[model samples]
Target: MNILMALSQLEVTGAEVYATQVGNTLAQRGHKVFYVSDTLNSPHQGQYFKLRFNKRSLPRRVWHVFYLIYLIFRYKIQLVHAHSRASGWSAYVACRLTNTPMITTVHGRQPVHRSRKKFHALGYHAVAVCENIARQIVRDLGVAESQVSVLRNGVDSQVFKPLAANHGAKPVIQIIGRLTGPKGQLVYQLLEQCIDLAANQVQVISGSQIDPIFDKFKTKVKFCGYSANIRQTISQADLVIGAGRVAMEALMCQKPVFAVGEANAIGLISVDNLASAMASNFGDVADGGKTELDIDYPQLAKQLRSALKQPKVDEEVYQIITEQYSLEKMTQRLLELYQSAYVYTKKREIPIIMYHRVIHNDPSQHGVYGTYVTLERLEQHFQTIQRMGLSPITFQQLDEIGLDHRFDHGKRYIILTFDDGFKDNYDLLLPLLKKYQFKAMIYAVTGTDHNRWDVEHPSKPDQRFELMSPQQLRDIDRSGYVEIGGHTVNHPKLASLSHAEQQHEIAYNKAQLESLLERPLYSFAYPYGDHNEQTKRLAKQAGYTYTVATDSGPVALHEDLQQIRRIVMFPSTTKFGLWRKIKGNYTIKKAAKPQTKNLS
Candidate 1:
């Protein structure tokens, strides 16, 4: 999959660093990653485009939107992950214009206002870096809770693992951040009041130029400007002071962190206060009334004095980071979110459930193929669908509504398709459809009025069942609740036949079904779900707007109209199993198991 990481930053901030790390990890896993931002300081594996996404000028914002559109088409980007509000706005516009899917990661608290609430550009789904930001997004930005997820910043444990303890006479203290923001002021305050300059060796790792006011403490503090190897620099420190990703990386290295941020101060992280610290993203965000400017320097001095006295590594800190913030785990979750967002934006992956027969009594005598569900179970399934608020739609309805407007009616839809046009469908299923006010698509075999093909098969020679006659098919076709589709002349596997034979079976069946129903068939179902590329081509040539196969096809329905996938409703399938199969990622989970025969 091709992914674009979009950001708007003047310098390397935590958001930028996080995107870089995620992009590199995704690239290593064989996904093509592209980046667009104002500045990219970290090493990346994908192509980078330097765009001034930080600029909010009218013309610049317009240009960013158009440029992003071009990049998306140029790279065939499957998804876009915007990391900042400015970039998200432009990226969201571009994605809409191109019909592409995008997700935004809210790395920090956003400025909330009436306009922001009215037009929140957080993309199709929003990923918050911490729980505090997730709440803020849902509450202030007017984003739905269902669309927000809290995924904390992940650290590369392999590189940030604990190193040899610094065993010097003086404990080393490191302050990491850009030197022009609240962090820079915090550094100056710590040097002047919180830290005993004579007792500890201090180093400042910053990308910005050192402030001239720090020249007085020049002899006491060592200025190490912008080390690319942060892990190596962190290795020499007994105590690390910073917030957000900085605090996370430090904790991953088993070093105690004095967590202070642009929002508030969370004094020296310990297992006792770990939950509170994490809730505020280690003080990078404001979780309560206190702000960074409201810091009590005298009280902070006492905490610092105590921290320097006994700076020890905490095993629980490392364990938490390892379990909750591992790079691999974050990448996996992001991938799942990307697929879901893509399906949602495209709105083409409607669940098409396949059912063979609905029997009135026990199927123990003729359930060899596991294809029959009891009438009671069928009613239960319908009740579940109604309770879930899923609209049972036919292919005719879908065509009329159009793919883009599938979800516009404020209810999700699923296609209930019954194969083989069984007599039970006309007698047993039509009333349920009327009772539930639901619609279904039934595939009819034009050549026979009974299951002659299955009866003739050596494997199931005695499993004969009655198929709906032409009159029954016409009645259902005009019932306003069922759409009739062709299912070949004799229900033979098309893949095992010659090209001419396949065309005869597919085309002749369509002609026969049209003659009976007096309406053109819009869909075709491959018998036994057995179809190759040739069979799909034949079905298209026969003039089917859509075709379905069992258990094999792309997850996104629009990707291949001729071979759309369907979930088979087996006899033993429970309500939970039905729910799982109806989900968008069911194909992904199904593919992991061994291939099974298509009982249909």
Candidate 2:
């Protein structure tokens, strides 16, 4: 297929380099490639279009409508891989004219919100960076699961070789990026990794005082000039660390590179394939039943840092994560994205979905803390959300979605959150969340005796699927969207527990959840809406930044991510009932029902 790459501008950036990199890779694969964009204003551009089709005065949407038609006819393009939402929608319009396929990659999940849903409806399939993104795309835009591909961009081992450390210099880490604007702030990790974490262990190299992001970390790390000759710098480094194109480049240079990312953010790199991950000890793959390439969650960077202390384990983990995302892997994945970009499909864009339970429907349970929403209702809910414009948003998106970024628009956006990990939650929930491209955050008990109300002896396995097992929870946690929030282990009445026990219940549960998820648990929800000032205090002590309560109202008003309230619609909440809550009206608006206990 003749592929046409589209972006607002071919500027020198990670995404741009990636597009250029992939274009270079694909070009070598013997495919006819063309480029179209706003301007060829990039660090490196051999040949591409001037894209002088300026649409000023016209509304952005209207310009896209007009450009969509022009690009289709101009290039006779069979496929369009839009780098930005602006380009993506325009590609959508072109797809209409030329019957081309269009695809969009949610690069930053930034607040572009350019409305990719139009492309989804018009033969557009979204290529998410990771599983979290796969689910997020579905949740955010009601996109069909099959159409949305979680195509993680891979690193090229051949090109980005592992670093050959000679043991002369302190360990070095390279963070290549601009130190200004939106992308600039990412280098702050240098402080956490270079200065703080590497205090006495390693030297950190990152964007410097030339950009504002360098001001804090100047004393800690060597300010490496922001340039493309990263190969030279990474070649002389002990550890090539960072995510995105940087990691790939480091790996291609044969340097052991560690990718620091949450379960969802760096969705592109996969630790599953050890052979292809960072080639440990200069391309020697780790060989052990317990693979060394494995890096657990919660403190992902911390885990890597600790592993770095253990060369054997550190090297293995590096090899796997690196190899998995090697340029070869990324190439295949990109090819798939490129293929999908031009291949028209009547698919759904992903959206955010909200879920209540994953178990059987119990009559006694109302909304909120009860297993009121059964698998049937849950499935109906997914179907209903699908019918509407809503799709599933990855739970991982929650991590990036603060003041910095927001949900995608135009397509639907759904937030799928499971209140109680009822036995059915795993049974009824997991498959569905996986099915509908939904990322669901499950709030389960971190304390012992934490579980669904074992209805009829619970009929659960040795481990309650209702409340996930450490391994299961960790697996879901690792999945990026299956966020594990504190539900009070042992289901204690927070108000009743003393400060010590309350602290233990909250903090201990978080630690336990962290153990399972392999990442520090950040969000929590009180049990039975029974948290008190003490409970809230304990929650904070336990490292929880956000806490959810049974605020029986739809989330219409702006919500505080931390201390945010929830309006649950359980089995008692019929579809009509939910409609009321979603409309900013309480479903059962009965004088703001009192908490089961004074959970305020």
Candidate 3:
């Protein structure tokens, strides 16, 4: 596939490094990778376009957009991937002009209020470098939860290979980035205060932009001007301290990294701190407070001096780099995003049936109306699904359909899901399901023997619904018609919990259910369909393959599997109401453009 990469500048920054690495990798894989940047210094082998983006004038920026359009037509660019904000605007315009798909990888925490609507209007999906940036885009930028994804910055392990043991007597500490930046200041302070303890010699390699601070540090450290080859410099270092791309590269080189980025300082990168370190983009853009930095010069120096003697986990660090932060993994996800980009712009109509209870509906037992469905009404709902010539598939099956695009044009697809895992699902719902020879997914609350979570509801304080027993869950598992998925153990509001609590709620329940069923569990349903990005991520990290949210809509091909959309089938919903949902007649404010491309 022919692709165009757009960035405002090819400056010596983390974002530029990421674009260069990804572009080069794609080119090597036989993709026709073209690049357009304000600066033409990227080391990647690509057909480059000279597009100056620094001009603040509107006419100049407009000219660049038109030039991008011309390049799109000239090179038959299938997709435009923008790396920076300026290029995002220009590429967005170009994509709109050509009706081509576009996506942007947000490199940092950018203040995006005025352009938020413009970003939505472009209908371009976003890639966040880390989870913090992902949240920033969703909450601060107002991008839809479905429209943003996290693709962490990756390094080429092959290019930045580990060297032989070089932790010699004289500890050589290296710092690489612009000297005027926060990284430079941090490095300066560290060496100035802790020089007697931390290092025998300190090396500072910075870009062409000279800072006056370099003169002040001349006596204390070596200020080597930027070299075209950075990995080589990293290879010679005993210890490396830098932010963002430099730290990742150092880790790939099997060197211990003291990660300090523009925003925060991550003291050390190790197995215990890996998750938090990466969340902050290795301290590059740590909007979330996850790092512990002893910025006190004397204490930092003492700590570094002590740490120098400790053995390094080079292999463990290398394993992490190859597994989670490799170029290949990043490229593969990017390809998937490119292929699925059309889903965001196009409306996909499908039906997802939501159920709470299949017992007899009594008016007095339910203060909240949607929680109970009569047995007869559920039977009618199943009959309607069958009569409408729709196929009932599990959540896993739904994901597979999206992946393979195996749709029957003559017949529609309907997803049947049961929440709370009530006792009636085993006693009443299973037989009807067997009668129809249909399959469904049941999200069980593993910690409880009953639906005690609802007792605290403001409106319905006395609703004490009984949940299915452990044996019943196993029974449903034994039956081929049901897929048992995870609902939280306590069914707490996931968003209200801390990250650690959220992880325990999700991962612990998955473990409990898998043990009970004696099988690998993949599907999950959020309790009350209430979850934030953190909750969804916890579910993914817990090894769930797909998750359903209570939001009313059809699942889009590009939607995050961790937060799949589902339309609720309440007790009050009639056959006609189900049909309208099946027909996608309900109003959802986010409208999609008419689809010109077919998934099937």
Candidate 4:
């Protein structure tokens, strides 16, 4: 497949390096690849588009967009991969013009602003380099979790391999990265402090040709500007201190990494701190001050002293880089993502069948017959779904397959979600689910013993239906076919509650359910399908991978997971009606607002 890679700039930043590595690798794999950037110093062999976007005005950007279209047409580019935000915008327009698939890899710690919505508008699949950025995209930027993938940056282990530990009278400690921005001051301070050490013992590798900040400590440390042989420089150092790609490279070199950059000190990289280090990309994107390092110098000094004494890299640390942080793994994952980007790029209209109470005697006697489906009708719905070749998938499965884009289009997916955790769901729904070999997700109201939230329903007042007991929830959860989710503690109107109250209701219910089942809960259903912006934020803060609402119609691939749309089923509904909804062609009248309370 022909691919176009666009980067905002060709600077020696981690993002640029990542794009170069992946683009070159794709070319080597016999794919027609084109690399374009604002400034290109080193060129790749296959193809190059030396388009500069730096400080570009509106007209220039528009022209660049047209140029991108020309390139896409000339090369038959099937996919466009953008690296930085500016390039993302241009590529987004180009892809739209050419009707090609596009993917973005976010490398910087971008602030969550209103502009992030453009990613959705442009139909750009997002790839976050770290978990923190992924969470930010979902919670702060309002991107759906299913629309983003967390694929961390990787290092070329073959090029950046372990060298024997440097054990000499004076340890050579090095810091590598572009010495500008907020980190320059910290680098200056580090160099000044290291003046007491012999000049040969301290080394700095960066892209800045000449800076006043480093001029003061020129004689104290060897300041090499933009060396092509960075791996050799890093290999010679006894200890390497940096962040992001540099830290990963140091770890691959089997040199102990201090991971101090961007004003945050992540301390020594070891097995114990590996998870946290990897989460923030080793302090490259830490939560700290705007201008200078937020590190405690005295403590850093102590750690540095200890690090200098113990320059030997831990075997586990070496293994972590070799196994998980290799360039091959990252390239393969990107290749898979690039090839499968089309699976979820467009929305899929899959009906999420909503159920509350599946009872035996529910022909017409039930006060709330809308939510009350007879066992026979339930069987018929399942049979229709099965006969139609639709697979009933749990929310977890949908997330895994859709976000990862690892499913085939031959089989369609439908979600069976039961809200309010009725006892009949366990007694009646469980057997049919097991017998029909279908999977369903049940959202429980943890605080209430009965369906009191529905007591004040306009049609059915003072209803006292028993909710599933904790043990019953545990039972169905143990069954491999059923997954448990949260539906707020008291089932109150989340939009009406204060943010704190909403958080407690949503998060507390999740905590209680997880405690009861002894497993993590990732899906949540808003009570009564009532939620505001605060409700969505709290659901994410509560740690739900996705949430569902009572909104009508089939769920889409790009629909917010926090408000997954569902098709409410009534007793009067038939197999044909179900088929229409599943086919994304039906529009049933929404059930009464208050009816949502009692049904759950």
Backbone Cα, N, C clashes tallied per candidate: 0, 92, 0, 1
Residue 490 local lDDT, model 4: 92
Q: How high is each candidate's TM-score?
A: 0.63, 0.44, 0.57, 0.57
What is candidate 1's TM-score against the reference?
Answer: 0.63
| Per-residue accuracy of model 2 over 216-260 as CA lDDT, tens digit each | 656656665545566766666555556555655665555655554
Best by lDDT: 1
Ranked by lDDT, the better of candidates 1 and 4 is 1
Task: Please give the lDDT score at residue 266 for candidate 3.
Answer: 65
lDDT of 1 by residue, 269-310 (tens): 888888888888888788543444668888998998788765
Please identify model 1 stretches exceeding 4 Å from their true place.
288-292, 349-600
Model 4 TM-score relative to the real fold: 0.57
Name model 4 segments beyond 4 Å from true. 117-123, 287-292, 343-600
Better of 2 and 3 by TM-score: 3
Question: Could you tell me the lDDT of residue 420 within candidate 2?
Answer: 53
Global local distance difference test of model 2: 0.53
lDDT of each: 0.84, 0.53, 0.75, 0.75
Q: What is the lDDT, from 0 to 100, of the residue 7 in candidate 4?
A: 81
Worst 10 residues of 2 by lDDT: 591-600
Model 2, residue 444: what's the lDDT?
74
Winning candidate number (TM-score): 1
Q: Per-residue lDDT of 1-600 in model 3, one digit per residue for the tens?
A: 577888876456677778888989877766678888877565987888878877748999889888988998888787788888778877888788787778888887766568565555324678888888887767766777777888878788778787655756787778777666456667667656765633466788876465676576677678787768898787677778777778787787777887767666666678787777887788767664332333666766666666566537556767876677788888877876665563343233456667878776667656454577888888888888898888888766666555423232243577788998999899998999899999998999988787777776676665677889999999987898898999988998898899999899899999999999999887888888889989878888889888888872234634467877777777778998777777643423343442322111
